[model samples]
Target chain A: MEFIQQVINGLAQGGIYSLIAIGWTTVYGVVGVMNWTHGEVYMLGAFCGFFLFTRLHLPFLAGLLISMVAGSLIAMAIDQFGYKPLRKIGMPRMAGFITALGLSTLLRYSSTALFTPDPQAYPANLLSYKLLTLFHINGKAITVSSLHLMIFLGTLVIMAALELFIRKTLTGKAMLAASQDMSTLELMGANPEKLIKITFAISGALGAAAGVFVGTIYAINTMMGSLAGLKGWSVAILGGVGNMTGSMLGGLLLGIAESLTAGFVSTGYKDAIGFIIMILVLLVKPTGLKGYSAEEKV
Target chain B: MLEVNDLHVYYGNIHALKGLSLHVAEGEIVSLIGANGAGKTTLLTAIMNQVPRAQGSVSFLGRPTAGMTTPMIVRSGMTMVPEGRRIFPRCSVLDNLLLGAYARKDKKSVRRDLEDIFTSYPRLAERRRQIAGTLSGGEQQMLSISRALMSRPRLMLLDEPSMGLSPIIVEQVFATIKTINEGGTTVLLVEQNANQALRVSHRGYVMETGEVVLEDSSANLMQNAQVKEAYLGS
Candidate 1:
């Protein structure tokens, strides 16, 4: 019952991790570049949500939507100006990864400079705090707040919609094929540049939405992105580097593991639990659980 | 119709396609046959704009495609069944086929053409739901060809379609290539399998280390003593 309670507590945060993991997984999948600044993008998104709702007096949902739009544009600009030029020069992929790391640092420090490194809170008066009693497990009434329900349900809805888009639409299927072999996808008449833009856009939008969800739940700060981004990438690696299904599972697993560790063991060890499980899984299977077979004919 | 004139493509300091030239007329099965490293693939990649050409002109339907990108070239109605049958191994067969038509605007007609493709390759229809990588090499090749065909291209470029296939499957692939040509899609195929490539193609260009050493009717080339010694075997 405590385990179940821990799982419930983890679900909201787990959903957030999985949402972020999908973003990191996608950008890596399409162009095979890790957008290192992905965490900063998440942070900026939180800031975007923070300002849009709190400053502009917009509704929470509306601010989240605008943040997605803004996040997507920001990511597209990063690709257009930063990575696309590197591609044109025919630089090695390692160069792109390095550039991304540099960009991550740039974005993080810039946000800190701009936002003054001060933590900000979402205005609580916007929404009333309401809790729902789910059930009584071992005489302890297990309950979830409206915000907790929102995060889990929101993540599920987004994921389900994304799955349907990938499975049912031509552009979506092209994304899957592009991830496998981008040149081949291009040779087949699909513009990889366009698909790449869409990939980053989708990734950024999710990151921003996750950002807003977090802001609503807890205070937001510039430093928050580092841990969130680390968790997202950890989840992505834990599931599989480029595998969508693996990333999702990896996020939930990390969340629950962290929660359970904090609940049963030392709270100080919660942060270490994710890395430990990732290492253990890597030892057992080099590819994450849902990762595809890496077969190349020489 | 497609034309490549005085083509020169380089991989760093190495000149892969050195002053090579070839042309394929409408409704012709043109094969570029050579040994490995003879620049057969490089010539095709240059034509498809996948590789940058140091100096040359590649025109499709009389439009100069110099500096054009792959998707742009493909959108202009030329698609390549690239070397290694680079099928989306993780994708389903149907999805792979659909990706071929990613640029087409005629949404309703795409459905009709898809049915047409399934009719031509019944084996593909049988495995439409199966993951592409799980299929045999020959099926993957078929999917690669069909995937290119889904674009409804005016011209198709196939690179080494028979490399690593069984003799019987090679026969089927060549026959399919012939059928594709007969159905009104011109073909510019690059292959190291000189004999079969020559047999199936209407005209053959023999490349010897980045130059077209011979260009003649396939039957004529098959009879050439030099060709017989170097490729066909006595």
Candidate 2:
């Protein structure tokens, strides 16, 4: 019963991790940049949600929508100002990586200075904290919070919509092709730059949604992005870098592992569990769970 | 028609194309034959504005394409079947074909053209749902060519379409190139297979070290002594 309870507890947090990892992988796959600032984008989104809820008193759904739009704009601005110039000058790959790191630092500190380093909480009544009882295993009832159910279901809907978009839409298919070869996409008469911007925008929206979810569950702080961003990268690596499905699965696995560690083992070791599994998975498969070896370019 | 005049392209310090000049008239199969590192690929990319031109001017259909982006060039009715068949390996064959028509806005004609392609190449139609990477090299080449054709290009640039194909497949590919030309799409073919390229082309240019060493009617170029000894292996 306790194990089942722990699993249930981990799922909502896992959903948030999945969103962040998907954002990271999508940016890496399409733009070929690590996008270290993504976590900061998530932080900014959390702050956006905070402002919307506390100041404007907008409803939760409206806050989520506004946060997502804000996240996309911020991400697109990062690409436009931070990375696009590097691309135009035909800079090396390392230059882009360094730029991402620098931008991440700048954004993190700027937010820290702007919002102050203190943690802020979402409204206690912003979401109903009603716990629904499922079944009694022994004498103890297994229960889930309504918020947790909402977060998990919301992630499922978003992922399903994303999958459908990739499969059914021309622009989405073009994005898939761009991941394969950007130059050839240009040969097909699709502007790769436009596709790249859209990719960043989508990635930003996902990250922001995850941020808002996390903010609702926990206190929001400028420092929150640092750890969350690293965990997201770890999830991306665990799932197989650049593979969307892998990131999704990896995020859930890490979340469950962490929750179980906290339940059965030391809670102090919960954060270490994800990285240890990632290292082990790398040692075994190198390509993560679903990552295929890159085919030699013909 | 495509016109390249004194086009100079550099890869960092390496002078890939040094003030080279070439042109393809409308309704003609013009072949540019060269050895490896002789700037054949650079010339094609430069024509499409994929590479920075150090000094040059490319005029397509009598308009200067000085600052046009590659996709803009493609949208203006020219596309390339790039070297080594750079098809989206993970995508389905049908998706690949659909992406080839990405820039086209006329949905009805695009659908009709897709049907036309399927009718012409039953093999592609058969494997439309299959992942492209699983296809044979010959099928991949065909898909690449068909992908270029999907753009409804007035001029098609082919870069070494026979690079890794078997001799029989190469022959079939050349035949398809001829068929495409007969269908009224002008072709700018770059090949190391000089003999076969000359056979299929209306005119041929021999490139050496980033400059045009010879240009003439295909029959005369085929009969030239230096061309016979250097490229034909006769």
Candidate 3:
């Protein structure tokens, strides 16, 4: 019963990880560059949502929508000004990674300076906090909250929509092509610059949405992005760096594993569970659960 | 319909193309044959506007494309099937072909052209949903050609399509090149397979150390003694 309850809680939290992991994975897939400040983007999004809710008195849903739009624009700006020029100059891959890391630190520090490095709680009543009993396992009862249910469902919808878009749309097809070989994709008449820009925008929007969800559920803070970003990175590695579905599964699995370990074992070791599983997965199957074959001919 | 005059492309300090010149008339298959380091690939890349040309003019359909980008050159109806069959490995065969028509706005016509590609290469149609990287070398070559064709080009540049295929597959690929030419697409075919390329091409140019050492009708060049001794291995 305890395990089942832990699973439910983990699934809810894991759903947030899934959204973030997907964002990271998508950008990595198309741009082949880690947007280091991605977590900061997430932090900025929550702050954006919080400002709208508190100052402008916008509805929670409206605030989320606005955050996504703002996040996407922010992401586009980073790609256009930050990364694109570097790529045009034929910079090494490591340079892009380093730039991303530098950007991430810069965003985090700037947010800390602006937001005072403290957690800010949003106004309550944006979501119902009513607890619902899912079922009972042993003599103990298994319970869940409406907020958890909403978060999980929202994640599923977004992932499903993204999957459909990639599989069905021409632009999505182009994105997949770009991931494999950008120069070849360009030779085929696709504008890699345009596709890369859109990829960053979508990744940013997803990160923002994850932030907004966290704000409504927990509290908003600049430092929150670092923790969430670390979790998102773990989720990406756990699922397979370039694989979308893998990240989603990895997120859920990591969440449940952490929750169970915290509930059954020591609470101090909650963070250890994710890294432990990640190390084990790397040792056993280096590609993660759904990573594709990487034996591409050079 | 494609002409490159006095082309000179530099890769940093290395002069990759040193005063290279070539032409492919409409509905013709012209081959640029040379050994490794002879600048065959660089010439095509320079003509496609992928590599910067220091001194030259690339005229396609009587319009100058000397300083245009690769995508712009492609959009202008001249596409290159670059060396090494650089297909998008993770993409499906169908998506690879669809991206070939990326610059065009005619959605319905693009779909129709995709079907036409399927008709041209039935093997590609069979593996339409399979990832392109998993395909055999010959099939990948066919996909590269089909992808170039999807752009609906007046002039097609193929950079060593038969570089690493089985002899039978190479024969099939060269045959298909002939058929593609017969279907009204002009070709600028580059190859180290001098005998086979010279057999199918209307005119041929022999390159040595980034310079055009010889240019003549395919029949005349094939019969040339030095061409046979060095390239054809007679």
Candidate 4:
């Protein structure tokens, strides 16, 4: 019963990790940029949700949608102002990496100045904190909170929709092709720059959704993005850099590992669990669970 | 019809194409034959606006292509099958073909053209659901050509289509090039296989050190002593 309870407790957090990991991986796969600002996007998203829910009193779903849209806009703006000009000048890859690191630092500190370093909590009544029982093992009820159920279901729905979009839509297939060979995609008469923009937008939206979810479950602060962003990167690496499915599974696995560690081992080591697993995976598989060897592009 | 006049392309300090001039008349197979690094690939990429042109103009079907992006150039009815058969190896064969028609708004005709491609190359139809990377070298070359055709190009640029294929497959590829030209698509072929290229082409340009050293009817070029000594390996 305790093991089942720990698994249930881990799932919602796992789903959030999956969202963050997916956003990070998508941007890396298509745009070929390590967007360090993704966590900042998530932080902004939580703030977006905070403002909408606390000030405007918007419904939960509406807040999530608005946050996602705002996140995408923020991500697109970053690409436009930060990365696009560098690409146009044919800047070296290191230039882009440094630019990303600089942008991330700039966003983090600015937001810290703007929102202050203090942590703010969402309203306690944001969602009914009811624990619903599933079944009993030896008379101890296995219960899950309504918020956890919502987050888990929401993540599943988003992932499924994403899978269908990637498989069935032309734009999605073009994205896959762009990841493989951007120049050749241009030969097919698809603007790779436009695809890059779309990729950033999608990644930002996913990050923001994750931000909003985290804000609901825990306190939100301007400094939250730093650690969350690092965790997201760890998840991306753990999932196998550019592979989407790998990121998803990696997120879930990390979430569960963290939860179990916190439950049985030690809460002090919960955060370290993800990084340790990442190192182990790198030492062993190196490609994560679902990652395949990338074919050489000529 | 396509035209490039006084074209120059530079890779940083290396002048890849130096004031070269060429044209492909409508319904003609024009071959540009040269050794490696003689700017064949550079010239093709320059024509498509993928690489910057330091000097010169490229006009296709009577309009200047300067300032247009590569996709825009492709949308204007010119496409290149780049060197080494750069197919999206992870995508299914059917998905690869559909991506070829990405710029077209005529969905019905795109489907018809896809069917036409499948009929002409039944091997592609048989393996439409398979990942493209798993295809044999000859089939990949065929898919590459078919992918270029999907854009419904008025002028198609082919770079080294026979680079790593078997001799029999090379003959079949040349035969397909002939059939494609007969069906009314203008072709600009870049190849190291000078003998077969000249045989299949209506006109041939021999490039040396980023300049067109000779241009003439393929029959006359085939008979030229210098061409025989340098390129044809006779």
TM-score computed on alpha carbons, candidate 1: 0.97
TM-score of chain A of 2: 0.97
**Candidate achieving the largest DockQ:** 4
Error (Å) of candidate 2 at residue A75 is 0.5
- Per-residue C-alpha lDDT of model 1 across residues B1-234, encoded as one tens digit per residue: 898899999998898888988889999999988889898888888888888888989899999998688989999999999999999999999999888888888989989988998988899999999999999999999999999999999999999999899999999999999999999999998988889999998999999888999999999999999999998878
Pairs of colliding residues, candidate 1: none
lDDT of 4 by residue, B113-169 (tens): 999999999999999999999999999999999999999998999999999999999
Q: How would the docking of model 3 be graded?
A: medium
lDDT per residue as tens, model 3, B1-234: 787888888888998888887778899999989999999988887787777779978899989996677788788888889899988877889988888888889999999999988987899999999999899999999999998888998888999999999999999999999998999999989999999999999999999999999999999999999999999999
Task: Give model 4's DockQ, 2 decimals.
Answer: 0.91
Model 1: per-residue lDDT, tens digit, A90-192?
7477899899988888898888899989899999965557888899967888887778888788888888888898899988898888788888888987888
For candidate 2, give the DockQ.
0.89
What are the iRMS values of all candidates?
A: 0.7, 0.4, 1.2, 0.4
What ranking emerges by lDDT with the best candidate at the front? 2, 4, 1, 3
Question: What is residue A131's positional error in candidate 4, in angstroms?
Answer: 1.5
What tens digits encode model 4's per-residue C-alpha lDDT throughout A138-240? 9999999999989888888888888788899999999988888889999999998899999999999999999999988999998888888888888888888
Q: Chain A alone, TM-score for each of the models?
A: 0.96, 0.97, 0.95, 0.97
